[model samples]
Target: MPARPPAATRRTAVGAALLGLVAVGGCDLDDLDPRSDPAPGSGEPSEPPADADADLVETVVTALSTALAATSAVPPRDRAALRPLARLHRRHLAELGADEPVEGGVASMTAAQVRSREERLQRRLADWSVQAESGELARVLASMSAAVAQQLALPAPRPRGAGGGS
Candidate 1:
């Protein structure tokens, strides 16, 4: 029963939504065949390199969880939030497994361990986020995510055996 947005507003909204789609869905899903590496070229690599931001996020999530697990500050009270974040990482890793494999069986890692790690990492990140709005620790964390993205982009080693199995 509310009034509709003005035409300009509607157009702007649609454009924003489309832009979001391209940024989130378009950039990450482009396929890169394992056997065909890009020929050395100019003008900032092509549409999709091997790794995408999403892949990087997945790796960062793991590292973050690991860092979290090893942290000393997180109290028991804030621990519950980590479960959902860990689950998100697990789901993201599963999707990555279908497209690109992760080093070490992250899927096989216990949920409890992941939860513990995430809790610690969250506490640490929260602390760091507070201390320096923009600084070395933040930069380091950001850099780690980028590194993970780059690694994800590399073609996975070809599987062994006749059927590509070990």
Candidate 2:
């Protein structure tokens, strides 16, 4: 009769098996971005993926559009600092094949209001990232979320010579 392995050895084997399963499972990426080039010789399918998830795509697009609008509404003092961030949102929209978002509402907002809007947008994007249906879409959403969070984390740029004595 074969001898049973010790408990510690059995636990180690089970742990290793679970870890291997995780490693393999992580590789299942249907990250096929519709915008990406065709695989090998497959020139092009009749139509692009558009999105495996129409709802998710629309949600992301709308969220970004709203956020972009907020940036536009920021008081002039803050717009220069926020220009790169606005551009980032536009790039994300472009990646999703969305046109530049229409600007509506709020010609200008107080600094505090702009900050609040950005914070809300960051949270919404983060939530949508994990909920996304496609792995590539998930990554894109997460990237946008991270970008927003990073922008928020940064100290607002100081006006030249404004901080010398303060």
Each model's lDDT comes to: 0.40, 0.70
Steric clash pairs (candidate 1) = 50-153, 51-153, 68-120, 68-121, 69-117
Pairs clashing within candidate 2 = none
Across 106-149, the per-residue lDDT of candidate 2 in tens digits comes to 66786567767888887887788688877666666666666676
Give TM-scores for every candidate, taking all chains together and pairing residue i with residue i: 0.27, 0.63
Candidate 2 accuracy as lDDT: 0.70
lDDT of 1 by residue, 1-166 (tens): 9998757654455455445543444322224232245446654455544432344445445655443342223334433434344344444344334333333423333434544444455455344423432233334343333323332233333323336547
Best by lDDT: 2
Candidate 2's TM-score: 0.63
Where is model 1 poorest over a 10-residue stretch in terms of lDDT? Answer: 26-35
Q: lDDT for model 1, on a 0 to 1 scale? A: 0.40
Compared with the true structure, model 1 gives a TM-score of 0.27
Query: TM-score winner among the candidates?
Result: 2
